[model samples]
Target chain A: MARSRNHEQWTSPPPFTQEEYVDSRIYSDQDIFEEELEKIFKKSWIPVCHESELPEPYDFRTTTIAKEPIILTRAKDGKVRAFLNVCPHRGNMLERAPSGSFLDGSPSGNPRHITCMFHAWQFDMKGRCVYISRQEEGYQDRLKKSQMGLRELKCEVYFGGFVWVTLNDQIDMTVEEWSAGSLEVLKPSLDEEPLEVFHYHKAIIPCNYKLWHDTNCEFYHDYLHYHNRITGFNDAYFARKNTGFDNGHINVGSFEVQYDNYEGSHSREEISFPHLPPNHWYMIDMFPGVNFNLRGSSLRCDIMTPLGPNEVMIEFRGLGLKNDDAVTRRSRIDHHNSIWGPFGRNLHEDLLAVTGQGSAMNPRAENRQILHGRHENETIHDENGMRHFYEEWGRWMDRMPSNPDKPFVERTTATSATG
Target chain B: MSNADAVRDSIYRSCMYKDDMKWQEWLDLCDEDFQYSITAYSPEIRNDMIYLSGDREEMRGMMKMLPKHNTDHSPLKRHCSVYAVDLEDDGSMATAVSSVVVYQTQLDGINSHVDAGESKVFLVGRYFDKFRISDGVAKFVEREVKLDTRKLDKGSHYPI
Candidate 1:
């Protein structure tokens, strides 16, 4: 209802190039969301859980991949496995709790098979139903137990302590291969020593998940943090570079972000991760929902998920020294929590901005918003990252790729000033 | 209960809930010059750091103004169960220990609940008129809140 920020029509005929955006319809259409579920989330190796969360054998956690609930557990042999959290029969959720020790059964719960709570149908962790209770009375010769266990999902763990799961049956790309340039930014901290997650915080924001992803991907908005502005004035951290790869699914946007300065405020400084040969401050907004950022002594990973069109849940994890002394560990936690936690002055402000933007989008109260900036090719001021996201989104949504002669989808919601 | 025991009870009642935002009631259980802090033990650093440090008046000002400024997050409540009670020899201050669990409820736009964590505390272990004691009552001149869960799940505009 607040007055819409002044801007140009990005998708219209004053002649914005196809390189800028595909269309706004992608934001509202449910069919598009389904297509994305298949082409993107189903195929990409999405982060499921951190290794620290399941260190001991049988330690398990349940999370959702796209709309499907997934179970990630450390099997007795020490390998971590992921499977559909759904019970094979009647579709009851196998693991109701978020994080816990797997006690009722093996991570999947069927002795040599997985089981369904509804009918007591059991199956092994390998997705093969091994047994069924009341076999004679329920179905004299009718049901098949051999074919029913919790569905096994394609899963892999990266060197940096993150476990990823996917729905696709044959994705040849390894986690490192998928992450590409991102590994360069992560290797410094991850290489020196294994990283351990010291803190986990979740915030539920009222907005579509893309809004959060876009906010994370783009850097021009750093000027909105009133405190960061004063502290980061000298650093000029918002300066960014956008790079696109041949695979098209993965892209990297490197930008400088300020670390809290001597004045107790932050100024963007060009600080590079130890691994990247280029010593420029940077971040890589990984596609399909993950961001890796490095600032000073710490590293942060933002994992975002869509609860619905109007709700998003973001989880932030701060990584630190694996063998830090007691005193150093405490300091790391404090430093991490100060600017990253729920009360973090800067992030909390950014979240509010996105949620507020969501408020307007939810009601279809605004028409086409613009995305024009001076530095398109030059990373520092370019709006190209967004263009890249839309490019990839279009590919996954089955839309025509942005060729010089092709026309992209055109969707314009009726505009209104809610105020 | 002995005089020392009574004093310990009053201190626990007042100070234990300070992080929970029961400001006035918490202050009333403290002496006029009380020092209250919300600190955490960092295993990496192996030290105690103050996330929030305040006194009665400071808390009063914070409790009153925080909600007005905080634009993000849901509401929360903390429930604590006492586990240990230790009485000093002179009975000047009784040190009581207990575990606490904070449940956060998202209220502004979403309806949800999350538990922050279980914390441990030590209440002054006797009686002290100077520190806050009246026959069967005990008040705190100082109180400390240590939390295991450092990152507040939904950092409220208000205290714990």
Candidate 2:
């Protein structure tokens, strides 16, 4: 095997390395971010919209896939589907609201097709354009409804009733395969009943997506949490096992923290709920931007988008078992917010740490990030998870990971450009 | 004091003492049947969503259990200044509107504040609230703190 090298340099460091990285690379490096938008985000099956958000026919919620706008809606048959949120005519955004049922200004609760506010161009739940304003007079029969449906995205629903969509039709991996390790952490909650997101919070962290992901992927930074002393985050038993699979996807970090591991990544900590393990924290970095975390009884799903190299927008969704009593659900929400909410103790500290890093690293290109973990352990685990990401990144960007130190490679074709 | 003044003073003192972290003094000002809450307008439904609402016992349990959990942000400082008061004829009840600015100070010394709201009051400024108060001068009969700022600056584990 090639001798593993630390990519840190004083004069000019590679944008990212297994070691510390410079701050400006995160904020200013458009080339690196575009590669991520393609290799990881566009190809990966991302949880675009939730099934619960669209309970009735024609009910819809518009969301983003990287920079591409998409909408999720329920068909007349009650099947959930995903479509590009842009209208077929005039390129106007079909729905302007951040989240709601429909955009036609019609009374809510009544079942009706989605009608674009611009020209009353209506679409069925399947995204087929059903009605167009003054159809027979101006345009004649040239505009076929068959060719004018809202562009559909590759979509699927998980066993837990969560909805996910992918831009690439060629990628063939089940949600189970993509989220293997995370599913273990999620099993306890999933085993009970289908989970629904009751509470949602978002923060646009001014840092790189990887910086925030590293904050969750590693367990060595408890000293930063001032409250961790009381919460038992200081224990040395908070060990982590980093594992990565083929295709540079499905990277998992499992910790043998101060909690009881019921079986897999699941833990029972007494800090929040007595049933929740105090010592366990498991996170799965799903290829590009999405990171799913199971911190005991509560579930936190984070989507980090590269607003730019330096700025990352992190949206958090909190999930709980569907049949929870009002009190139990509220308690879980309290516990989740206490630790990881935008105002929570743990996440706030982590955000500060990464934001501080962003400020310093972006301007100085010589810094590198250190990820030297257990390489010789019995299994193929190490900072290999991080390495796999860069390797895949290198593969897609036409750069060399073995020599990621080389000058940046610029791509002529926009990664978003269609084949 | 007139009944209107009594309810007005009661709401003022309760908010004042609560801001000072004087949980006991805040509880003492409330009536046995008092009701209190903190709510927000959800633009999704164009309706109000209550973030916190409870009686004295619920308040006590919340205050008791809050410090035990972990949190994401920093300390919050609330300033509630009453601007107008509407009194009932018998002085047994009253309605009060106030403006409030809640400042949340982060560890890095960053502070963000929510600066607007209106409060509805009853039993104009009294020692015991018109509603039933519970626990050791440690709770309220009823309370409601509504927020005009829909998107919170940074959330806190405790009520506003």
Candidate 3:
């Protein structure tokens, strides 16, 4: 048999041994994907939205996590709560729209309640089922509508900015621990002067959820981003630092970006975020699916959820300071749009890479080899971020991502996994 | 040509120039102070949103770096019809609204099969524009795209 030459970098400085290259099976196999939905997606604490989304009591934003629909709402008591969007009776969706206020907007003066369109079952902002149709006449003795409220999940608003929830409540570790101390480091920057999300959009891509995430973690893909190359990738880019904590969380340091280096590029002279200076960046990739980031004058957060084996939904939010003037807000908006907007110059190229890699790594195609062995002291070009992430991924699924295998947990256990 | 007709032609040529990838020609048509943005409203959050925004210099920078980026080979063809044109009383400025629908045709790459080459409606929107008319020529000062379609299939690197 010929020697396996999968890991060698034919042109680059560092050489990758066979162990250095990631195995192709993780990208192709169905068994490993299912395990991820349980071990990673369900168990992870995913950020749902910025708390500013529902500033008033009884306001709510609805979203999905790991294919499970969820609703995040503010209570009358000044607390944010999360629940499965499913109503207990007949499992109908409580709120069908993406977001809304429980308080009646009309002059009809109807009291605030979370009412299900079907069956006329009414719930309060705290998810208490206050009214049930025909409760007195039918099964009054046995059925207790008061006993049932919308199913609640463990939800917390972090650093007074983001709302995060976990489907598995017994995961033991707190949000701070799961993030491995990075959350604290980031909170000060996020909260100091306060930032509000000014832009929001979601795109469903034809790629695996992990593939969509790889675009963020893999640094060598910089070659694919011309704008980044032209205005970025200078001495500062090469001098960047990366830190990886436990549980697959990675924070890559910033290189001073010169947006003016490219022709027609304008300077971000006004409106930088709370802690950052002009043209600087801060990024944190939490394992599984959330990325909180700052670049130049705009702050952004992206959350990815798996739609299927071959599909992923990504939500992007652009943020600015709370007190920006019209010009500063416009400058922030312009800065945000230039790079992170749905029509951004960077994202399309990243999506193409993810989808293209997905297409090539499909089961029918020959199983391939992917390398994440670069070690330039964990700089922008290093593959250690991806490697660190996959290693943590392996620990959770109990299967090395490179040499993939099915991880079978009891089906009863999985029921709670979706809680 | 009448000033109104000249103004109308400039707007028509802007869309055509963009569709044809005649970048420099399109840049020449815009005023020095051009500002372009794509804006939308989300009933979900009850807020108006900005998907993209830039001025002339920023637009120029994006175009300059566009060539080096790995972009989709799906050439977008825009179908636009001028809906209304209102020149200001001072005649120094004008505003126009146009209905626009862009179709994407997969023209390049391994996936660019003949079947995939069939164009499809990518987005539907109205273009809200402002122009500065000087020396009997109209150049774009601002273009705000009010989009109706929020569920776009892929990343839209190019302006609508």
Candidate 4:
């Protein structure tokens, strides 16, 4: 084919249906990004942190969902709770650190209480206001402690002890319902024994959060990962299915990785999770950006926070069985870090690609068509994972993905199986 | 040169070889059983984590495979300052502490038009290095990179 003229270059569309491509504006437009946070992220169930992260009473972790600060604590009753990390008095952020224990007293806080450094307000692990400086003298019974308690959010600890929270108080679905069985494939392995996080790191990538999730959704990009290409391109790998679930979740079926195919790489079979076949891998990409990947020996969870339309902060956690002996734990860490760590063989390459995409689709850049056109019987190389996700995204935003100017219309074809 | 100076020289040579992407030259400065690791303490998880670790042979294999993988070809210049060297009584072994600040020059890819020739700090860390001196020749036995910067943007295909 001859090279196109300038007008044709700008006007021509790819020879594919609307479902096969989405407008680049969905990734680079500030207005669409903010509306996504409100319509999709805020209303969806998000895994804030793992329950094991706050094992002891008064242990707390602070995070955000759709930019609303949240604090999760292990209360005296041994239940995990989530609340807005704001001092009701003046809306000051209550916890400044990423994580800590409230058991020790600070200069401005009492033992076993969440403290607001701005005004010295204190709340218990359950988020009940325990102390307020000069409450009776200043307000004079106008604001009681009962009415000043922290705003509690809906929280649940399930599906392998992840603490799932939602900013919407009236969300209709439970965490299980939200997952829609996307996690069933690895349920036995993940729930067989308690898990403990052995590694934690985060990177602020210059890319939209969905782009990172897109990386997780499909295995076609394995071409970009030499490690995966060398070890995972066998017939079994190509035959593995991409199963889409409701609420934008997708699962890549298990496939045995030939770990020893690569030079200096060792088989992870010996330390495979309980009930899991040696050398097998399974992955689940949850809606609005969360990934749970179970390689033979370790479980890696990626939680994304959209800092802006063109930037995202991804927290990476690697977990092993809590009862792992020192030697076993060391081996698990090695297996995890070998592929997924910040300096890992594969993750840096993924980050590099996404950052490239981000640079090309910055807010000022002209909108272009981003393709998702491949079709391969819903197998590993199929693009249905992303197509299904955008279908749901269009529903939530009530806008067509290919043409954001038009309202969303449901397609009649059954591109995905119901989870 | 003094035994301590020899060990310091070995450390400096390793940095230069790494900056030049001369993997074999860098490996030549290490002992047969040398261990290399990049570690950091994450306040988020309240734990010390190792991001990368390998023995000499494993390191060699990884470096050999670098060409097959997609990597950022931007050049890295490591500025290292050896702060202290403690020589053992026999002068056969020494331990050195140094501060490292790595700067990367963006020279390739899309941003080159705007960022080419511009240098940005890539990493800040301390190196705890141990060496074994044989006949006045020092080779690294172990090097632990304890990094202060945890949020490595886009990270690196090679070790820091």
Ranking by DockQ: 4, 3, 1, 2
Better structure of 2 and 4 per lDDT: 4
TM-score-based ranking: 4, 3, 2, 1
* C-alpha DockQ of every model: 0.17, 0.15, 0.59, 0.73
Model 3 chain A: ten consecutive residues of lowest lDDT: A410-419
Task: Give the alpha carbon lDDT tens digit for every residue of B1-160 in model 1.
Answer: 7765665466456535654557778677777787765556444223344555556676665455444343544444546555655556676656555565655444442222322232222121121122445566776676665667654423444444
Lowest summed lDDT over 10 consecutive residues: which window, candidate 1 chain A?
A410-419
Which runs in model 2 stand beyond 4 Å of their true positions? A1-27, A102-111, A180-192, A227-229, A233-236, A247-281, A362-388, A400-419, B1-99, B103-159
Lowest summed lDDT across 10 adjacent residues in model 3 chain B is found at B107-116
In angstroms, the error of model 4 at A80 is 1.0
For candidate 3, the per-residue lDDT at A184 reads 57
lDDT tens digits by residue: candidate 4, A1-419: 88755866764567899988999889988999999999988999999888888889999999999999999999989999999999999899999898889989878989999999888999998888989898889999788999889999999998888999999998998999899999898889989889988898888987899899999987899999999999989899999998889888899988899999988999988998999899999999998799999998999999999999999999999999999999899899989998999888899889888988988889968778899888999899998999989989999999999989899999886544521
Give the deviation of candidate 4 from the true structure as CA RMSD.
Answer: 1.5
lDDT of 2 at B124: 20
TM-scores, each model vs. reference: 0.70, 0.73, 0.89, 0.97
Question: Considering summed lDDT, which 10 consecutive residues are worst modelled in model 4 chain A?
Answer: A410-419
lDDT tens digits, residue span B126-153, model 2: 1222322122122234455655554442
lDDT of 1 by residue, A1-419 (tens): 65543355333433555545433344444555566677787788888667877776656777887788988877767788899888767789876766765445654344433345566666544455667777768877776665555678888878477888888879988877876655664566567656777666567776767777877766667566654454444434444455643233223444343344423433323222345433233566777778776655456778877666666778777766677777666555555555565545556667767766666565333334335333545454465566566666665655733431244453354311100
**Residue A232 CA error for candidate 2 (Å)?**
3.6
Which residue ranges in model 4 land beyond 4 Å of their true spot? Answer: A2-5
Q: How many residue pairs clash in model 2?
A: 63
